[model samples]
Target chain A: MTATVPGVRRGAGPLPRALHPGAWWLWALCLAVVASRTTNPLLLACLIAVAGLVVARRRGDAPWALSFRMYLLFGAVIVVVRVLFRIVFGGGGGETVLVNLPEIPLPEAAAGIRLLGPVAAEEVLGGAYDGLRLAAMVICVGAANALANPKRLLKTLPGALHEIGTSVVVALSVAPQLVESVGRVRRARRLRGGVGRGRRAVRGILIPVLEDALSRSLALAAAMSSRGYGRTGAVAGGRRALVGTLVIGGLLGVCAGLYGLLDGSAPPALGLPLLLGGLAVAVAGLAAGGRRVRRTGYRPDRWRGAELLTVGSGLAAALVMHLATEIDPADIYPSLTPLSWPEVSALPLAAILLGLLPGYLTPPPPTSEVPA
Target chain B: MARRSVGSAALGALLALLAALLAPLSPASAAPGLARPAAGSAGFCPDASGVTVVVDFRELGGGRVVRCAHGPQADGLAALRNAGFTVAGTNRWGDAFICRINGRPGVDSEPCVDTPPSTAYWSYWHAGDGENWTYSQRGATYRTPPEGSFDGWSFSLNQEEGSAPAPGLAARRPSDGGGSDGPGGAGGDQGGAGGDSGGPGAGADPGGAAGGGSSPGGPGDAGELPPDAESDVEDEEREEEAEEEPDEEPDEDVDDDRSAEAAPLPTEDAEWSGTDEEFEEQSAARDDSGGPSAGTVATLGLLVALLGAGGLTAWRRRRAAAASTAGAGADERPADER
Candidate 1:
């Protein structure tokens, strides 16, 4: 009889490795940029097409990835419901009245209610078009994720960010380890008959999770020191550095004050300044941070031409979306009123989908280096 | 292949529908009639100078035409007669007259109203005749540069039956044949410089009587015309010609060819004189017309799109689950004992 060893595996099946995590990040950025701009149907539809092309190229004819029957059925039902809802409750400047619902009165109430509809054709269709674009974008993103592996995500980080990257990777591992520790503690508690109720289980879980996390953090600190981290003198200080710090701090304070004065989501004048200030502070901090260890020897992998293509495609999609869509935040949801549904529908969903495409073609990390 | 085909087909139909639906409504694709201004602009905003002129036109239509100083021209019954316009109708003491073909909507310039309307509406004078009066009780004082001399001017009412007069050109005919030629009057008819009243002979004969008294000074003196006098008719003929031809430029760009006229204040001896909102309710009515609460369209679209995405996700999940189940079932077998 053949024996099976059960544990977490290093790599997924060879069906087709998912795109790199960088691609997903790019997709997210593109979505944000595209959403800021257009709701035009034509542009969105084109984006959807590009997303499809990406899917096709990444995964070799994965039939289920771009499933249409389910999507269409869902879309049709939603459209019908939306149209009916709008008809019943007047909206979108729809004036054509096809029928009215019988009035229903609350007993002894001053007001009674009746429903109204067939909303104008323009509003219904316009709403549906927008819905379609959003759906397309979402599907493309999902397909990209499903096809790409998460294990290789760290490969994309810049070498300068190795410590932060390592921290993040270790931090990610903590949750799973905590879960395992909790299970062990629960089992031990059960064996000792010390926990019986749901409350006991929560106590059991929390204690072990926290203890494990703390212990792991201590061990991490020790391991980092032993490995000669910060050997490159990243934190050497001088008066010039102090002056730089003071200047940056003062500028940041001023920016913070201005931000408080002009605080609002839609005001780019305010947001842009804050963003620039924050970026400057971050760059300064990075510049001033303690050194990288010479012996640690961590380096970001060179991006291949194929990888560049994937990233470039995502960037292109994002740029195009920014150019094509209406960037006015007001258009998305007008203030002091119910949200602007019609305008929201006009978002370039298809363009977002295209932007999601590059993530699909990104290469996954080599299976050999994956921690088991 | 079938799935791909279905996806592509649905995408195509969706795209085509979107394209067709979007053709006419975008600001970029505004209706041709209302298409003069490009996107994001109401057009232009004129300053106080423009506002003053519009106010002047309103005063003129409101029959507030008082006699006042105008530039350069001599004043007399003959001169007054030379500046006549045909009144279209009489109502509420104000008579509407057709403006010349090239006549501006009013003195207001384009700068007075061109933004897309943080607050809606651009203020400009529209020259429709008849009882559509824009009333202003602004009286005789007008602001002028500290160093400039004021010219006397006269205001009149005319009713041109079929056609409008040329802008700034009025026809005046002296009742007593004081002999002022039309637009470019000859030298002999100069009754007086400035807006002085005509001589005794010119005043005694009703035929030569000036329509209004001597011109008054200041800005509020923009509109003052006597109801009972006819002036000379020289420029009036040229106005008729100008009216016969259609204006080359758009209405917004139309400019006045004649100098602005302000009527003189009446002389004490001169006889014959005459002499006018529920905000909440209005707002409610306008609000009702404003159409559709926010994000209704977007929510509807989102719901539909999400439903589509969710359905697809579920289907894929189910299919994968089923395939895994099938494979597991097929692979399962009694442990082999060797």
Candidate 2:
């Protein structure tokens, strides 16, 4: 409709030109849903790929994207180190001997060296594949974060948790403000004198920062009270109590389901039902809470063919990867020792790449320098 | 578009890097000392035909020494006193003790008896000994010196003719119990001299074909007694039973076969060499794979990550919006500020 915001381009394209930030939750929720159902490598891979593409397409240039890419790198390092440490120290009889160092415990095979010392060819390849899958997951999450703006996202929050959402939203913003305030304090100090070395910088920074933070908090509290915040003047009798109980009970049920999953002995048939029931209760609580709040005009994220493709392609790719990849991180030994290279099916990769389409179309807000 | 492509390429590179790093850490096995039996403590003593006590020496710490863990043969005279077998001779040997039952001949000197074999019994006080003892089947021998006195023991039980069931006869269903036992009575009658001569053959008879020894009864037939072929047969039967259990799958055979084919079968009592260390390796591998319950954990982890990201991203956007509209809310603050 109205392109009030700069860079808000309009087109008759199938996908929503600008996805409401709230939709990011749907993407995350979808990942969680997929994860809960299957640990099948193919499914997890497909899920990760699709989410990654969505993230890249939406907000690849955002700070989150950069950190995510780095995170992937970090994950890879961890994999290599883990494998190396294991191969050198861990035990497994192997035939192909490498070095016969006295300290290393000879035959290389007997010293717990496989493929080679601290470096089995098979284990390395498997670890790398696992690392890729992990990276894909991180990127997907990063993309979601980058693509969605905060205010719009809060709107999608279940009404039952408005206060929680608001609190969380405020707390998160505090970090950047703290960073900005530090800059201001530094500037103020620089104008007077550089605080000439030796720990004075720490004192100069801390004192002003604390004073500003406290003053701001007081001002915020006073302002909120004058505006009648949290005073909706509704009768807080039976219904309120009932709603509160439902919310707490639903939360507890969700925790119980999680505990059952952790326990592992829980029957799938029973666990799934409990989990679903808990989710249903939670959704109901949200719906009830929304009904209590003031009425507002309807606004919904536009669903288009491209957006569907974005989500579908990602989901499909993950499913396909899971099915195709025989790489069970758990069964890494057999999977690695056998050393059969899983055929990297091109079609699924292509599908996952396609899923990144939406993220490309949706750009993030321009990064701006804040005034202290 | 070029920027976007670059970004995607960067993402791919990062994934590759992560894959590389994680490769080395896939799952390290534990040290050899810790890993347990590869097929898990099975082949050690499959089933109880004759009880096999594997001391698992590591389970038993050091200090107290058992002069002879096996039976009296290895220890001889000294072992009799150590085993509390009623010392019959002067307890002279510093390392050895000779003994005989009060009414019977000492096992060290007396010949192993024939029919109605003499039973050698011994009892020791709990005064000094803890519950550590090793007793081996008589025919089994120790290649190395015994760790301590009564550290382990081995012996045999010879029965009177027609009394004990023959080898493999014990395992058969009771329905198949009726059989000829010994040739003594039959041979006596066949002499055509005394038809009433009562012998072992007269008591129980399994025709010569069924109960025949591997070779016709030779001299000292009671001495060796073929070292009990029933033990091996019993082992096979137990394996069959374990496999047939509803809970156990046939896959166990595949593993056993693989083990048999892959490595040399470790001898029963040779230096306690086996794959207990492999258990720790398997466990560690399991840990890397994120364990059996990994899928659920991964899902939950993703959910938490998403929640954090969503909340943070929203807050950032809100702060921006609030900054842009700061002056709009400034004027309304007067009524509240007062």
Candidate 3:
């Protein structure tokens, strides 16, 4: 139990305070970017492992922290669904046939489409690889959700995005809130000598939990509004219009720039120049709009060395993976047609290993007994 | 209660209908069928007994290849394979949408994970002996090429349907009198029911007609009687042509090699050997399947170790918290309770 003092370094370890929510988000999103760059299951599994390790080490004893298991289950479901789709549709034209399912002949209109036929090992593995990539992305986001406090994340948002951030934070917290409500409701039911099982038990628990959650959220909304959470100082209509135009136009430019960068065939003018220009314009607009709002922070989270190290480690992982893409694309995207085993290169593996740094380098999350 | 029973019955009927629709119409047939053992030639097929496959690597920068495929059951995809050509399809569409042939646009160029953009893709075409190329409307998996026909794959980039370049080689067989302009003469007798040979303007007609006609029979039925009969007749004619021109095979092989060496782009005479030992070696290397490599295994071990470390950290934290709670009894309740 240490006080939330600024720059209180004690010997080797930093003081046990929660890392900035923005730092956790940046780290997790960078991990997601690493996952997106490759379909190799080995690399994806490594990413999932990295995310799980970080979550286990850094997550506070919050209700939302427990939802990581649900995300893991969702990821499993995604892999299963992808494999099932491969089975239901034709499992491609790979040479290695694993199962000979009965082939269903479709009508002439559906000529190219094959219903269940022979399942190929290659096709199933390919589906699994693709599914793992998506799962890694989802789990990375989930890790961020578990490790970072949603309210704190909203607080970090710029003034221009405060109203939107408030809504988003509320939406994000709903699942954890509902979970807490359910537990409370079930505990109450147990005290009243009711069996918390079967269909009747579900109905009894569900109604009260929902009601409790709704009332709690309503109270929160009331509290937030009373405190003038989304209030903005009066500004001239023309100034508002100028800010709106700048933001919207910048956002459009960013979208165009991203499209151009991802697509090799797109014109050169729309790529890096547009992206930088759009970012500059957007930042300027946000700054101008923020000047209009009158707000003060109450012990706002500080970005210390630990936060810097955490974000830097994640960025390094992403950068290494990007460089790996240039070195050997074949290793990143293994051929599935011939059913070769997916292999990860040394460089990308080392990059993923770097993702483990934040788990050890950042101070352990403060024990929950410490009062805020 | 009565309404609920009625709804259940309706649901049951719907489920039954779906099951029936999905039920296999016949016993499982061998999917690849009985493709003849590949006897790919260095040039255009010596006779009309087989389908000749030509791959034009236009913008992808490879010389044109002509190889012959023999079999009654040879569809467009089968013909390509039977001609000793390896093809890769888009992951989304399987063998239906041809993405790469002999791995031209490699993983770095096009990953083949999805349907390639219309800007760059292998455009499918079909032609008769000494006939103009027609763009195929149907996918390769569904369309069965008739005996004596030519299956062409040209890598088209940002080209419209009409403008997409076809395989550089003239679809003429060497036995068709070595004349450059013999399509008119050959079209009269050899152009079968499927071969609607005209100029590029008339290409769409044959393709559209074949697509519509073949739908009812499907790929399986389309590969049956006509091709068998045509192959038998052509087999006899091929023997006669072989008797007449005994020394043309080696001469054509030499011609093919020379043309291949001269042209960087695909040209009429530039026919690279699809069945070359070099190509076989490359394909063999590509198809070397095995278990995970040493690096992958090491990485997996590292992942496992990380997970273990995570578990240890979590367990330690839990134990330390328990010790603290036991030591400081009613002074602090658990955070979960709050």
Q: Report the number of the highest-DockQ candidate.
A: 3
lDDT tens digits, residue span A172-191, model 3: 88876787777777777877
By lDDT, rank the candidates, best first. Answer: 3, 2, 1
For candidate 2, what is the TM-score?
0.47
Write down the lDDT of every candidate, Cα atoms only: 0.35, 0.37, 0.64
Question: Which TM-score value belongs to model 3?
Answer: 0.76
A37-94 in candidate 1: lDDT tens per residue? 3334434444444444444434322233334345544544444465455445433322
lDDT digits (tens) for residues B207-251 of candidate 1: 211322222332223343322222223222322232211211221
Write down the worst ten-residue block by lDDT for model 1 chain B.
Answer: B86-95
TM-score order of candidates, top first:
3, 2, 1
Cα distance off (Å), candidate 2, residue B187:
28
DockQ for all candidate structures vs. native: 0.05, 0.02, 0.19
Superior by TM-score: candidate 1 or candidate 3: 3
* Segments in model 3 whose C-alpha atoms lie over 4 Å from true places: A1-12, A169-178, A185-226, A229-232, A248-277, A369-372, B1-41, B158-162, B178-184, B188-197, B200-291, B315-338
Compute the lDDT for candidate 1.
0.35
Q: What lDDT is reached at residue B33 by model 3?
A: 19
Clashing pairs in 3: B130-B171
Give the alpha carbon lDDT tens digit for every residue of B1-338 in model 2.
23333444444454355344434333332222122222123212221111112212121110111111122233223232222222222111101111222212322223111111233222111000111111112212111212211122211223332222122111110111111233333333321221221112212323221111232332113333432334333433333232212311222242234334332223212223223333334434543332223443444354335334433443344344445445446543233212
Instruction: Please state every model's RMSD to the true fold in angstroms.
Output: 19.7, 20.7, 12.2
Off by over 4 Å in 2: A1-17, A28-56, A60-67, A77-81, A84-119, A122-132, A232-238, A251-267, A270-272, A295-309, A314-334, A346-351, A360-372, B1-338
- Candidate 3, residues B202-243, lDDT tens digits: the string is 222221111111122222222322111232223233332222
TM-scores for candidates 1 onward, in order: 0.38, 0.47, 0.76
